[model samples]
Target chain A: MLKINSVGLTISAVPLLNNITIDCPRGSVTALMGPNGAGKTSLLKVISGEHKASQGEVEINRQSREDWKPAEIAQFMAVLPQSSTLEFSFTSEEVVALGRTPHATGTVRDAEIITAALAKVDASYLAQRSFVQLSGGEKQRVQLARVLAQIWDHCECEGDASTDGILLLDEPSAAFDLAHQLMLIEIVQQISARGVTVVMVMHDLNLAAKCADQMVFMNCGHCTAVGTVSELLTPELIKKVFSVDAEVITHPVQGTPMVVV
Target chain B: MKVLNTRLITPRLCGLLLLIALPMVSLLGLMTGPVFISLADILSITLSGNGGNSQEKLIIEIIRLPRVILSLLVGSLLATCGALLQGLFRNPLADPALIGVSAGASVGASLVIVFGSMLTANGLLLGLSAISVGAFAGAIITSVIIFRLATSPQGTSVATMLLAGIAISALAGAATNTLSYLADNDMLRRISLWQMGNLQGASWDRVGLCAVTAGFLGLLIPREARALNAILLGESEARHLGVNVEWLKRRLIIYSALGVAISVAVAGVIAFVGLMVPHVIRLLVGPDHRALLPLSALAGAILLVAADALARVVIPPAELPVGVVTALLGAPFFLWLLVVQRRRT
Candidate 1:
């Protein structure tokens, strides 16, 4: 499990996260939703150990985040930002192979894993294309392949039941087309089925409602609500937090709460 | 089934071809000069270490050998530095000299040329090579300033790095000009020749120093190839891939500066070897640092040796400064690269 205990973060004397606390269990896909400037990316940065919480602590698998070696943590967890600002022209497959940096290099198994990860995202055709030449959505899917390859072999809980590899994505579907977005949902579902914890920052509420096992609603750097889709995706909460009027009704197909704005 | 169509093959072939080409160029460099030593004489002297006339032997061992070795050594260092900074800044336009290290280093060298003889007479900067020390310090100071300016919360912004380079270059250029104005006739001549860059000053000791430093850098730089590959993906993304981004940045900066510092100290700031060699090599092979770093080093060696050889023959009796040749060649190529980038973007 990933545990955040009253975590507070400040960047340049401006607080971005205030006393944030949450628990993310294994084999779950949690969708983090917030408006712009809602500290979603900052919180993901903190969880990935890219940023530190000034007031409280974060733990992974019951051990403090600080206690884990970077490599040790990396072997089981991966993070993908909305976009990678890579300057060089690495082939898409080469970009995917970098996910294996935390693992090993020059092994046939790594090649298999890389190809398989790209196949999972339907990005196998892009493998030979230059990453720099790819379209924005194509690049995002390539990066998705990278993170998937990072934690692909992490199927077993090392010592704790909650120790399955966790994947944190900041606005993973922000640039994705409808097909890729739906493909991302299926990919996340399959990854979760293999006992991985998935925490994704998502901008589209409908995708969150339809695809996520849980929803986390945030506003002004504070997580306002967190629960199952039915419990949290209420019209009142959406109107209050998102400043939008939406009618919450059961999805005719999946029986989950659907928000119609 | 094997994944034989890996990215590894082309670079491997390129490296092999480069390795095969390097010796031929070096031998060509060894053979050419005013003396017109026969190929057999060059080979026999090179292999046996003692043959031909004593004067020819002296020419081979003391005069020509150090220049050839120095060119290769300095070339590798500068090219590797360029390759590194390109990766660090995540921009193809980010040359090692973009931070004004070369200009600042030249200023340090100019100061040494103007006042160094007096210092030696007074024995003040004792047990030290004044020019190298000054150049190294100047290069390092400029690099550190640019590094500090470029790094921020949003990560190392390209604008800050480029702006700092321009500001520092202008400042250092003015300073060096002032020093040149103040220099005596003899000091002015030294400053002028040194500023243009000369390989005629090559010595065994300087060759040894560069050899060791360049070897260390050549071996050590490839180790960071994996981290550099990720760093090319940006700092945060590299970190997400488990690279220690801060540590990687520090190592790359220090080593690149060290490489440039030594090259400048030895070679009076040869322009564009760092910028041109890596870019040309990158275009040919690809931008994978594992390939870029080592191939850049080899290609750099080839370019400098070839340039030095041409420097000897182009104006036979009196050698044109190697820096002028590199700049004359590099400036146009660099402009062409910019044009190509502009079109692509």
Candidate 2:
């Protein structure tokens, strides 16, 4: 389990996150929702050790984050930012291979796991193509492959009952087409099935309704609501958080609560 | 199935081969002096405690050997430093001279040549050493300034970095020109020729110093190839990959500066070897530093040797400076690279 205990973060005297306390329990897809200036990305970055909380402790599996080495933490958690700019031309396979740097011991088995990660993301066809030449959506999939590679052989846990690994993503499907967005949601669901906690910053409330079991809403660095999608994503909450006029109606197909104009 | 199966040639194996081959080539260079010495005579003078012919011994043992050895050492050092700088900046266009190191050394050497001869005899060598020391200091200072300016929360800005290098280089060039204008005729001729670059001043002491420093740096850089490769993705990404990004950058800067300073100290500003050699090697072999670093060193050695040979034979006894040959070769190659890139688009 990943636990944030009274986490407070400030950037240049401006409070980005204030007294935020939450838990991303194992085997749950938690959707983090907030307005544009909300502290969603900052909170995710704190969990990934990209930024340090000002006055709180982040613990993973009962151990404080400070106690774990960076590589050791990487072995247990994988993070994908909203976007990245690559400086050189690397093949899709090579880009995925970089994810194995923490585990690569010049062994053949490591290569095999990398291959499997590429296959899982349906990016095997792009293995020979340069990442620099790929479209934005294709590049995001390759980056997803890289994150998958990081958690491929993680054996510390088996199901929701166990808590050890976490996957944090910032707007992973923001630019993806419908097919790729669904594919990513499926990937996250599969990862959560294997006992990894899935926490992500998402803009599309409907995808969150479809994929997330739990949702956390933030407005101006403050947690507005936290609960199951059906309980938390009501019309009033949507109006208050996103300032959008929407009706919270049950989906015709899946019966999940979805927001629609 | 192996993706890159051409050959898993380790950098260590390449280093070992170079260790054996470079000396043998140096020996060959020594034997091919103005006066021909028989193989037996060469062997006897080297092994036995007798100079069978004093004139032959002086020609073989003294004149040609140092020049040949210094050329190889300086060539390897400059090339290796070039590869490190390219890796550090994650830009193929970067070189050791990007920070005004060459101009700095030229300015220092010119200062002593212009004034020290009137004050004391044999001030030329002292001036050259002073120039080298000054170059080393100037390189470190300029590189630090540029590094600080280009690094920010947004990460490294490549365009800003190149612009900073160009600005600093222009300033150094202005200072170098000011010194050049003050130099007298003989001092002017000698300093100008040195600035163009030469290996004709090679001697045993210079060769020994350059070789040791070059060998250390050449071996040091390949060991950090993994870190260099990690940095290709960006500093923050590299840190995510478990690399100590700041430490790696500092180490690369210091190591490359040492090697480049030694090269400039011995030979004057030889251009394009550092810039062109690494780029060509990166194109042929992918950006995997494990392959690019050592290969760049060898390609650099081969290029310098070929350039030096042409320098010797181009105009006979009045030898052209080797730097001219590298620039002549490099400019066309760069133009062709641009053309090919445009055609592909």
Q: List DockQ, one per candidate, in order.
A: 0.52, 0.36
Best by TM-score: 1
- Candidate 2 versus the native: TM-score? 0.85
Error of 1 at A203 (Å): 1.4
| Clash pairs (backbone) in predicted model 2 | none
Relative to the unseen true structure, what is the C-alpha lDDT of residue A229 in candidate 2, on a scale of 0 to 100? 87
Proportion of true contacts reproduced by candidate 1: 0.59
Weakest lDDT window of 10 consecutive positions for candidate 2 chain B: B1-10
Taking the tens digit of each residue's C-alpha lDDT, what string does model 1 give over A1-261? 888899999888998999888888877888889899998888998999988788899989899988987777888899998888886778889999999988874679899989998998888888887787788998999999999888878642233433588999898988888998889888788778777888889988889876788888888889899888888888888988899999988878778778888
* Candidate 1 clashes between residue pairs 3 or more apart in a chain or in different chains: none
Alpha carbon lDDT of each predicted model: 0.82, 0.75
Give TM-scores for every candidate, taking all chains together and pairing residue i with residue i: 0.92, 0.85
- Residue A237, model 1: lDDT of 89
Candidate 2: docking tier: acceptable
- lDDT by residue for model 2 (A58-176), tens: 98888897787777777667888889777666678878888877665565876787788888777888887767778888898898888777676652236422335678888999778
